[model samples]
Target: MPDALADALYELIVATRILANEKVLDAFGHVSVRHPLDPQRYFIPRHRAPELAEISDLVELTLDSEPVRPTDFRLYSEKVIHGEIYKARPDVHAVCHHHAHAVLPYAISGQEIVPVFHLGAVMGKVQFWDQRDEFGDTNMLVVKPEEGASLARALGPHWTVLMRRHGATVAGTSLRELTFRTVFTCDNARLQSQAMAHGRVDALSPGEVKLTAAHQLRPPSTNRAWDYWVRQVEKAGLMPARAAAKGASTTAARAKKADAKRAPTKSARKNSVKSKRRR
Candidate 1:
């Protein structure tokens, strides 16, 4: 079995891929897990083909976006966006940022991740920064620390925020919960978009939203929702446990072959020596 960290990290990465494959994440996007030992830092898999990531590939970065790898100094260019979010929100241990087809209009629009449906109520009355200085038509704002700070203020206490014309953000106290926010926010937005397609939309009442919030404020229930979503990922075979297992076996076999090749051969030195002493 994988170590605790590896298991959890892979689970999160797999979940991110599932969302990406579902088209929740576009050409460029990310999900990060806060380091348990270091609150000021997090781990994220760097560039090149989102579909190809493994537990060991994730690199840790400081809030300033520096990686331990000297060659990886580039880090996640906009990693400060996530860093500031982690710093500002004590309740959040995971965050997801990605683009969505239906969310694009809402991202750029004056609209917020409002409680348009029951699922959205979990976000605790969503809000938006509405063209913040740092993120004008972009998903990131790590160009400057002050600008990133401004974005943090806009994120506020809500679990969801829409960066106009860029994308959406979701934070949760746990990896599962954050992923739940990430997954459900898109779902709720799509549903709202569909409903609004009729032109005459019936917005959820404040009282109704509040009632939903009361029931889903925390769980017993929301946790179950998060777990169920993970199972759904498994059921759809996107988790692909078999693939993961096969990959592991293949890796082990390659390592064994490498070790055998590197092993000292009794005749190896004789094979390379001069006839004078090698025999």
Candidate 2:
């Protein structure tokens, strides 16, 4: 594999494991990264638990969410979630779909997820997409292109969108950023819930949201969190094969290089819009 592609796949696997370890994804959710060399394709693991994802488990699919080659491996039924978002948002190179426990109440209750703290600002303005709004409900899985496209339209230019009564999908300009947002978004939800139990929850003001997000979502902050999460995964003995072979020094070097290559541009950062009430 080319260095860029190999690094992307390696980080993708690491992101999957990190999210699983953090409980942002239990068994059903998935994480994917767009092809570094090809805009029309993306890579995600075949049907499996996020914790078990490895480099070999990845399968490339077109933006239409069709497999590039015939494979006996079962694909994710919601793979279209990743593909359609890629088609809709060129600035997004990574996507994560999860039904994390902390975010479930918001999804089920249609409550808005706002920045209750500084780190939570990374989530920007969370959007909402109800399948029933257009499809009038079925199994609730985004298995069809039209379904995924609807979700993508709801996502608009935001970094995260909640699927009503289902889960939330997060997009990022890089795999590390995706992982950072997924984990912290869950943390923010849990915090917000706890705060609500005490008294009125004061979410960050719009100016605070923009300022904090600009500061916290930088490469240095993301790198720090990524290193910490990778260590946690390593301690759990969940590191992917390639990452383990590369060792910490090489892994850190590659991470820096990947960040340099895939870091979000100014336009990409501006893509996150302020939160708007959705019903």
Candidate 3:
């Protein structure tokens, strides 16, 4: 069996890259996973762009959001978003925060994001969390515990919440679930807006949400979605460049080994020595 923490770190990196490839995250967003063995802590990447996040960039943090060890890489200012949600929701094992452009209009206009299609059923009952309501006026970032806690409260019992004029937070029971929710939420928003323009909008009814939720959101389906996006990301060459280099080196080494094995042995040398002795 793989180490739980190591697996979480790999998934975290892949999720970050997937979000970036899907355009759900630009340079600003982040994703995290609650440590599989240690529920009291979670793992988030240092303050790097989601596309640039690597396994080495991850930092282990307590539920309170402090690093388990000192890090030279700067921590994310909005990590409170992940930590506080983990602290508040024991059932949630993964979190994603993104400034998706398609959903920003809803954040500003006080509109609820609804599932216009099947993939979006995970967005169950989206709520809005406006920082101004409590803080009155600041940078509008969830940099403090109280602010993060307020956001968590806004997300109560829901899988998604819109942060007024900032972005959105998505939670799930696993990394694949969180990735699915984040990507589909953005896709649903774009599709919903386009659908609204054509005619009367029709979102999934509660019954529809209940019926289709499990089929689209669980293991085999979730794994397929994650795998597809990861392949796309890899195809686009968004992963670490060193990976390609390492692959090339490994292939070259294998080729060299094969050539050595196929080459003729130096049996002629012994024959020449025997011939010289005869001379």
Judged by TM-score, which candidate is best? Answer: 2
| Candidate 1, superposed: residue stretches over 4 Å from native | 1-4, 68-74, 130-142, 217-228, 231-279
* Tens-digit lDDT track of model 3 for 1-279: 544555566677778888888999897988999978668778887787888877666666677777654446678888888989999999999999988999999998888888999988877888999999999997878888898899999999999999999889999999999998888888899999899889888999999998888788879999999889989988998865566334434433443353355323233222222111000
Instruction: Sort every candidate by TM-score, greatest first.
Output: 2, 3, 1
Candidate 3 positional error at 233, Å? 1.0
Query: Model 1, 179: alpha-carbon shift in Å?
Result: 1.4
lDDT of 1 by residue, 16-69 (tens): 766666677756677888865457557776653444555445665555545433
The TM-score values for the models, in the order shown, are 0.74, 0.86, 0.85
Give the alpha-carbon lDDT of every model: 0.63, 0.84, 0.80
lDDT leader: 2
Candidate 1 lDDT (Cα, whole model)? 0.63
* Local accuracy of candidate 2 as per-residue lDDT tens digits, 1-279: 346876787788889999999999897999999988778778888888989876777776678776654456778888889999999999999999999999999999998888999999999899999999898848989888899999999999999999998999999999988998999999999999999999999999999988999898899999999999999998998887654535433533543464466424333224323211111
Clash numbers, per candidate: 2, 0, 0
Clashing pairs in 1: 107-164, 108-165
Candidate order (lDDT)? 2, 3, 1
